[model samples]
Target chain A: MMSELDDDLVARAQHGDAAALEQLLGAVRVVAVRYCRARLGRTVGAFTTADDLAQEICLAVFHGLARVRGPLITYMYGIASHKVTDALRTAGRTAVLHSLDELEGRADISPGPEDAAVAAELSAQLARLLATLPPQHREIIVLRIMVGLPAEQVGAALNLSAANVRLIQHRALAQLRPVANEILSEVNP
Target chain B: MTAHHDQHTEPAEVQHDEHLAHKLATGQPGLPQDPLSILLAACRDDIRAAENPAMPLLANAAHVAVRGHRRRTLLAIAAATLVSGGAAAVVLARDAQPGSPLWPITELVYTEHADLALIRMALGDARAAITQGRYTDAQIHLDEAARLLTRITPGTPAQQLAAEIGTLRQELAAHLAAPAQQSEPASQTPGARAATPASAGGTTGAPTDPGSPGQRPATPTPGGQPPVPPGRDRPQPGEQQRTTTRGSSRPPR
Candidate 1:
């Protein structure tokens, strides 16, 4: 029901209805912030906070709405993902390390026992393996897996062809396989 | 042990591959734990906050609308001014003497062309100066270039070229105006001046090579040596000097 209302509101916004523009943004704000926060959590305490970066993404989307020509939810997600990726690229190493330091300092945001063990182990292994892959391949994998974007939408946001997205996905998985197997064996044994 | 090993190897490979594909599809882990769920939920909240109807989006729309209206109004006024100015010029031209230049304004226009070309050449020289770290010379060339461009008549070919030259001039000016960075001394060549109108018109005794020595450099060279004067004699090895007296017979204006 909310989805239907969101679509209608977006349509009105597209046609220059400011009231509807506000309503559509209201519906999508949570999704936008969370997407940014999860991926950028490690850098939360940097010069540009995850929330600040998220706001930048929102401002970029608001101004860039005319470039979109699809369903509002889909377009919004695409814009959000692109902005987050751009922000990460622009933030550089100092910002990233600062964010990671913040994450380390935070005591209240710990993962659950089961997932914590898995995530900690996986994140450590993945970090090492990720250094081996090209930036483009790493980005596609992060967008598709961590960010939970559909391959088609990921391709659209990244300005990649769908076929290219699938190829990158295949290669990224193939690269991760050996590492994943090693980690699994160590864990299960 | 052999049977158990075989069972584990094949199924494990299949499961791992499938899990990867599933991860790609859902953009999340197959094992959904509480922390991951919390993070995903938070992301959803962030998206909602970003999209909040009462915030920055409305302000952005208003700003764009105002800018668009102002641009349209400016464009309309400029178009009307050009049309009216051209009509008045045509009416005034019809009342003038028969032998007068088709457009007396055209001579001014031609002069403008030469000036624009000179400005463009000067700007190129300024860019070279900036690259060589001669900030003072670059500033002087940039100012002259701007003044030359400003003198151009608005509807001529030179005017169009002036617009392009103006942008480059501004950039050069800004760099020159900035505080001097570390200065590296550059080797200077004698300046090259534009061809004089007399030589360009094929007048007798006009310098064949306007860039030759004996002609004064219009701008000071980097090493303080004046540029070679145009049309001074320095004959190439294989070229013959043929004096074919053509347009030189015309009476001087």
Candidate 2:
């Protein structure tokens, strides 16, 4: 169910209602972090931790909450989307390298053989395929498909028109089709 | 090689490819043996975990909001203090002068020079816009230049040069505010327009004897050089001269 907090909670939070504010933030954290991880995963070597980045998103939402007057989820998601995009821009290639380094550094952690092989193969393929799409296209696909934001909300969050969002989504899907087909074929073969 | 392949076989392949393309585009859930599913699932779990009520994410946001509010309050207080301090300084300076120190004149010159500089920048920006065929943007800069120049004060002599500078600025503003068809070529002379009134103010012409009270002094212009009458010796001693000129130009308010 969508979060039901209203403008009153937002106003109260602006006047320093910590509890109401926390409730508002809790409602949207799922979609927000998912959006961040997906967009960040496409980057190279991000140095900042995901939890830290998510915290930054939370801060931006709280700071900007007074100006946003809508359903808490929509407003929160909008703030989250902007924060995720900003984090991606700031982190650039570093995010991907950092994720890979983290994986490599965990020598004590043992994956089952099947899981390890699959993880390595999938990570390598994603790294290569993600490089093919433009940053904007990659962002929209991750937000809509992986993060599961509706088209209207994605458009609002990204500061794009809904029509533009759909158009970009279409282009992104078309571009991914051949890669998806090749991946399926390779796996089946 | 013995039996010819059916043409229908090629059509079937094309249809199958089309169907697969549609499925991929639609993101239909037919779980292919893709390994990324586990990773995707894991990421989904992380997202869910982040949403938990026990996490500190929400509490952190509350702290940040409080800090931001405090910072904004501090900035506003600082700005108010600065403005009040500046007004007090102006009052004390005025009281210390025996005769009317022409503050109005100085204000006029400072205002005029600033307005002129603004106009010049606007004109340059407009020229750039015109070249780019962005008439709307060019018009905006031109309008701002005009508004700045219209406020020029002309009569104050204690700040006479400043007023003159203001007049020149207004002139520049007027030029810029004209229709695109009438815009003048950029000024070729540096500080030329501001220098026009120096002779008329009696500061540049025949030096007044030091003994005379009403006579303009022949004191060597602040740069240790002979004074050129209006329209003549341009002060070229960089920022020092400009500062002295501004100081000498304040009008009796």
Candidate 3:
């Protein structure tokens, strides 16, 4: 669901305000980028980078802007989810996703060699752990962590009660502990 | 899926498990060097630096696209209108006598060599009649040209032709109202018919074609100069007869 601010921006954008359109798109860009990062796995190709996937989702959001109304973020998340799912299916059929250093022309990865290697291992481990969760639990973890959505808001977005969101999230994290230890133990030992 | 582990774990390890679960829920790490935080920061940096292609509002894009689509549709319609009209004009021009309304559409739509040739002949005859002071004959030609202008399809060219016809009509009307006014041409060309006043005219005196050099009709109106607005013409009484008339008649509709 949209925050009150996003809702207002969406309404203005629907009425043909160009500034509001840009603002609404900007608000969604980061969340959509994080969501794409979380869901796209460790594979990095031209279509696999968070930025590439986020651009795709934003284009889809703008294309469907006229047909939708209400909480802008939820509507956009739906688009992101659909695009991510489609990308996953396509990636499954296609074998290789090449790794890349630069995403958008000239952006440094910006971390030391040790920090980058550790981060990559953790990302691979987290991707596996997230994939193991039930779809609903996985969605909760992503929305809660990646989008930084509060439980009440996530509940509103997913049509689940706030209590249900907390319960599912607790169980998901409980399941995550042993797997995280396994990855850490492998690296340390 | 792992309920059997609950019975096997000791208290210290249970606390450790709780600590890890708590960290995951809060997006934290057990140690200061949390790789999750590192991953998040790197992704955020990359995303922030990457440029997004600009997009216009959907409604604006749709409006422009729809308008462009409409213009394409209209052009197709106009091209079809011209083609059908051209074919019709060919048949009619072959058989057209003096008083055909189809001549107007043909003259306006197809200004090809043949059509321009025919229209020029008619306009040239009208200009000749004006120089000869045949007001009635000139009025007939002006009336035909005016009527033809109305038949042209609504577009830019039609507007330009309409403006030209407007200037010609104003010049002809001014000539009819001010018979005493001397005109161009070296000879005293006797008028074929008397300049008759319209049944309802507002001019109380003869109107001069004010500022027109040598009192000539401003027909074949000068380029880069505005046509003489009828209101700008001064009503001058003849040099000898101080008598005036009122309520100058407007140019022929």
Candidate 4:
């Protein structure tokens, strides 16, 4: 639904409609926020918030709007891909220090009473499993399953055909299943 | 998604995994209690529970950016309009006459070069008035032309216009000094009609004499004034000589 609205808004914005561009920025910001949240779910000491990363992506999209030739969502996701990757690299550099800091901060950092601690662990495990895949396959799965974009949009974002996207996704899920089954047995038993 | 499902199923386990992946990707309902479905569902549930404290701030930032962008765009358009509109006004007002509606614009944009146009316009009015036998009205226009000639740029065309103004002023003076009082000045006696010399002398005193404000009082108050009255309260011609380049519409070379 948002992808459809994005296409129409992209057309209007490219034709110099500022209101359409604003609306498009807003819609894209929401999706970017979701993608950043899902991808960065388990970073230990998030020096940068997912919303900040999403805001950065929206700003990049706004600045690069005139140069966009393909779908606006695809262009926006392309920016998202780079920003998230840069953020992850930064987080990786600080991971050991953050982990040491987490030891002291564990009591304050406990999952809240109303929240499911197992869900947080499971989300971390899922992120770890996803991190094991190749970058392109990981991106496809994230955009397809986690971000809930249609396969066609994922294909467009990654510059692949939809059929290729499905093939990659199928192979990716097959690879994830064994490890997923192992995690599932550990969690359930 | 279904099309990809039917086309790529090789085995039962693969088909089952593909179905689960499809359900998760498309957010379909009624999933089986498979290992992958539970794992993915737990991940989705955790992500859904993740705090988004920055959503409102992000939204506000987007609004601010949009408003700023809109303001910048409007300012750009306004600047372009001012530039292009000014150029268009100069172009349209190039041929405007002294008393025509666009005359002020012409005078403003083509300040140094505009005296020639002003002289031409006054000459045109004087010629038109003389043909209609309004001698006092013609004298007023010729006087305006003579006043313009005092500070007009010195060039061949200006010299030509000055000579034409000279001849027209002389002819108008002769016509006003005639004894007939034939045209519209019903109250003027012969002695009052003899103020054509004063009108002609006003132009000479305008360029050389600084303290003579009362010299042209009788010249402007005559009964047979032109339909479009002269600017009696205008500044002195010496003070009005803003001799810039006048680049807009200078005659050839």
Best by TM-score: 4
What's chain A's TM-score in each predicted model? 0.58, 0.65, 0.80, 0.82
Tens digits of per-residue lDDT for model 1, A96-160: 67556557654444546674554444444445555567877766665555555555555665677
Taking the tens digit of each residue's C-alpha lDDT, what string does model 2 give over A19-117? Answer: 554455544444555566555542223212444455555434544455566655567666666766666575574767655755665333435667556
For model 4, state the Cα shift of residue B62 in Å.
12
What DockQ does each listed candidate score? 0.06, 0.04, 0.03, 0.11
Worst 10 residues of 2 chain B by lDDT: B97-106
Deviation (Å) of A98 in candidate 1: 3.8
Candidate 1 structure, TM-score to reference? 0.35
Candidate 3's C-alpha lDDT?
A: 0.48
lDDT, candidate 4, at A151: 70
Give the per-residue lDDT of model 1 (tens digit) for B1-253.
0011223234555455445545533444454333323333333333233333333322222222234452243234333423542333323323322112111221122334344445666667667866775444554565566666666666766566656555654554444323212121133232321344443423233333232222343333353222222332222322211111100111122
Interface RMSD (Cα, Å) for model 1: 18.0
B174-203 in candidate 4: lDDT tens per residue?
544332223426575556645666533455
Query: How well does each candidate superpose onto the true structure, as a TM-score?
Result: 0.35, 0.38, 0.42, 0.49
Among incorrect, acceptable, medium and high, the docking class of model 1 is: incorrect
Model 4 ranges with Cα > 4 A deviation: A16-19, A44-48, A96-116, B1-19, B50-253
lDDT of 4 at B61: 33
